[model samples]
Target: MADPDTLAPPRPRRWKRLRGGLSIQSKLLLMLLSVSLVSAVIVGAIGFTNGRQALQDSALDQLISIRELRAAEITETIDSVIRDASLQSRNLSAQTLSQTMNAAFDELQSDPLSEEQLETLETYYAEVFIPPLEESSETEYSDTAFIPDSNAGQRLQLGYTSRNLDLDEDYQELLAREDLGDGTAYSAAAAQYGDYLTHLVEEAGYEDALLLNLDGDVVYSAYKGPDLGTNVNTGPYRDTLFAQAYRDVTATNSVDAVEITDFEAWIPSLNHPTMWVVSPVGDDDGITGVMAFQLSLHRINNVMTGGEQWAEQGLGETGEVYLVGRDDLMRSNSRLLIEHPDTYAERAADGGTSPSIASRIAEIGGAVLLQPVTTRAISEAQAGRAGTMTGLDYLGGDSVIAYAPLHIEGLDWVINARIDTAEAFAPVVEFTRNVLLSLLGILLGVSLLSLVLAQAFTRPIHRLVGAVRQVAAGDLNVQVPGGARDEFGDLGNAFNDMASSLRVKQELIEEQQKENEKLLHTLMPESVANRYKKGDETISEAHENVSVVFAELLGFDDYARGLTAEQETSQLNTLMRGIDEAAAKAGVEKVRTLHGGYLASSGLVIPRVDNVRRSVEFARQAVEVLDRFNAQNGTSITLRAGIDTGTVTSGLVARTSLAYDLWGDAVNLAYRVRSVSGQPGIYVSQTVRDRTQEMVDYVEAGTVETQGQTETVWKVV
Candidate 1:
């Protein structure tokens, strides 16, 4: 038996089998399909990259716009508040209140507070102020340290603040309850100018308004808070920025002086953050007490957050603008904390916040001075620069942020607008997904189309390729099928036309070869023309004795101007033909013809013993031809001719467009003799005169200049 492996019909490898199975049509299909899919993928990748960048830029630009707008709004609002506070301090009502309250407080100084009233004032501080203060500030406080000292101050706090702590009435309601029954001049002053100062807090959105005498005593309060009876310059809150602003204005003591204080944690107002604007309350007496207007945090938060209309303000989901102090702590409320506490806590913890702080932020429902916003944007902005960047947000999530420093006086705050990268780049993700899907669909479609097109085009292409090979091998008679009505049919028709044109061009080329040979012989000597045709790039020969004749038709320009261009050309052609026949008959070879001149030679390419005589005879015949034309056309065109016989060099010039020319003493002397002859006749040089005087008739012609030397010339008759 045969070997088992051999009998199994040699198993083909996978690649070999695949290669054998694929025809030209299959290969073409695969190549086109691969190119189409790769191109699509490349295009899709480029588009995705560009689109992602564009979306990122748009997101950052949007953040920057929000940041700038909110910064302007915050600055303007703060400025307006400062102006209003300064103007209100110098108002007539405020000045009168300050003078009246200071007098009333002086009168009530002797009337000391009862022991029960002192106890109530101390109890209010201990229960209402110190506990929350200590909890929020993380510090210990003694209630007695914060309680007011003078009996007059203690009585006022007991009547307005301590008694009204439970009702939770606004400043207007508390101000309306003016009849405190204190039965003292202090009560009368409180009732008299209290409404105007209360209006500052109620209508103007101030947190509180206080009137302080020059001694820094809190003579009156708008909301009657625990700070009502306190001395700002020398009391429990003496170390606060509020007191510092008071001292600053007091030191200036000018009516135009207005001082600002940065936000701080104050024991009053339940230990919440507060800011102040202090200006002098004055009259014609010059300087008096100062009026302090407490700035409301709600107004700032409303401006920064767009009244919680984040979407309407173009801050998409998870976008917010807030303020940060130089301490890297939040100066405004946190959006996430207000909207979702648990979520905020988780994010805050992830952002490296201690668990206790996160819980406390959730407990208090605020972010001011609690949430940390330490980031590159914050650091740069705090350094007095403004810019936009992408970095980790406070929640430790990748975000785009825009930050700028506020221009308000006495405040070191920066504003930031932020959005998560996930939200900002959502469009890019969607576009990427769509592009990938489109690429997949395009690949499938291209595969099917390539297969169909390859099969249809391969048959005709194979035939055309075979025909081209035959034509390339010198078979121009080959034809391809031209029956189908498609591009292949058109290509086949064009091919047949090309082949027919090639056959016609072959016949024309043979005919043109003969004409070119004839024209070349007419231009130069037959021997020189032959050398040039045989690829001789340089063709030059010296003849020891050659006759050169130069002839020009005088008066031709003026004569031809009267004739039309066609008529002029015809007249010249007729004259040239006659001269050519005459030169051939006279044994002279025509070298070249100019606009109205003719150059010819004898014995340059052919040996001739009588070249001088033949050249002079040719010039005589040329004059006769021009005479015939002038007579027939009613013109006075005449021929001037010169001839010489000597050694000459003849060759082709400007090889790209072959121009046969001869030049030597013989040619130059001939040209000079013809040009200076000054009359229409055949002039010959002395060399020709000596050589051809026996055969040709001559006359005495004056000498002509040749190379700055004079030479005798003869006229052939």
Candidate 2:
């Protein structure tokens, strides 16, 4: 107290010395320049970041829209094809055709083809069918005659040429052939229906149409080639897609059902990729035969590539839509390959694709059917996910992909619309470049002007800088002096408001983080939840000696069908809550609940010494709960549960839906065991029974067929 000046804090002497060396005007000039430079830099950075993100979002939205449109068109096309096939099947289901087809089936089943008939069929194949294909391969058509100059016509011509089987001559020869006739009813019907089928193909835009009997014998073909009278079941085409489709349609015995085969290399079409759509032909009695139509790839290509709507739909130079089968093979030709084969080939080679695949791309002249795709988008879409992603495409370049599953019957296909990322983001990149250049020019001019205005605005700005430094160091309570009523003083007041807002926002952020953690814990195990909270992309672990339980509510489907929507939801919730309580009491984790089924696990999330015993106890308690519910509600609901103990892998699935699930043969066997239990009660696999035999009582449930094997199960008593 005696020396008040010395007692006061040392006064940050170095800062004072530095401040004292500069005039107020010079200090103000530096502060203004620094602020101007930082603002420009920050604004430029924000503009670049926000602009790029907005562009990406817009691009993805457009891609999704295009993908949905293309998917709809494709579905419509498929539905139209199926409808036409159904109509044809109904038309061909006349009593006359049915009786003839049945008679043909009887003749084929009762007796093998005679040597003369077999020899004649072979000669027809060699002379009539094989010559046109060989001739097409050896001889080139006149450019004016077959190669159309128009782009659309050229695409059609390319598809026609790619088929490599000019069957017009074979068709005419077959039509003219009136040689010794086979006395079968099939032959008579074929001769009569041939002209009608030909007209149907011409009118309906079908490449060809065929009528086949139950024995897989082609009774008639519109083109009347080697396939007519050829037995698809035992002939050279026995293993073909058409043969498989025929077998499927015949096996179903559904008159209105149709089977569409996946695109495959059809040897009859000179190894060109081909697709067949087949429908059953029947008249009241049962399915007597099948009607099959060969689809043209050109039409599919046109729809997929946006033949007429490409520009109108805003699909830029690099945008395209295509289809991929479950096998990850292209179902339609690739736009890139069609328009720029050399570039596509070069990119494919540069991406380290197999030489065979690259050579095939070139060989087809950019037609991509049957070409395998290994992109992430196709893989995810095949796995039943619909979304957008940035990844490599079929041509091996970076692309933005939007894909969705195509839910056509008897086919697992995904529709993907994609564009090269560089092209898609070109506007954003150019805008960013231009913005940065303009920002530099503005910053230079502002720096010079800031030096001229420094003297008039130095004191409050210095105070503002000090306050900003304090705030940057995590002290948001600091406030700059604002006695002056000018721009500088207004800035000080604005900074004070921002600091207060930041403090409140920080508090809210911490509270939200705690709430998020709590919510995540309810969704998954605490340890896994914590990892996910810590930003782990994949949270999966393998546990040894774990027990899994699969419980299905028998007759729930029928019971639910009779309940109102509210009643159904309430009843399901009550049942699930009861099951959850039972599992929790037994120290087992309820992993997930599916329709009429619940999956739980023990010793995975929290290891226990008697996991199998716990799982068995959980199942028994669940059955008791259901029994009580049924008694109280006057319902006949019953629980069927299967328990198995083994190693299991568990993890969170899907970023959006976010489900914690378990996967292993043990889990699969548990489900199978439950399904085969037949009568509802607690059913434990042999593994579970063996592990918890001493702790739980069980009676042998006999050997139940499960997953292609016989396994002894036990009912918990």
TM-score per candidate, in order? 0.59, 0.55
Candidate 2, superposed: residue stretches over 4 Å from native: 1-24, 92-191, 252-254, 285-287, 308-312, 366-369, 437-452, 459-717
* Candidate with best lDDT: 1
Any residue pairs clashing in model 1, and if so which?
none
For candidate 1, write residues 140-232 as lDDT tens digits.
Answer: 988787667766677777787777655346556776766577688888778877888877777898888998988889988887877877888
Quantify all predictions' global Cα lDDT against the true fold: 0.82, 0.75
User: 419 in model 2: Cα distance from truth in Å?
Assistant: 1.1
Stretches of model 1 off by over 4 angstroms after superposition:
1-19, 114-116, 127-140, 165-171, 283-285, 440-717
Instruction: Show the lowest summed lDDT stretch of 10 residues, model 1.
Output: 11-20
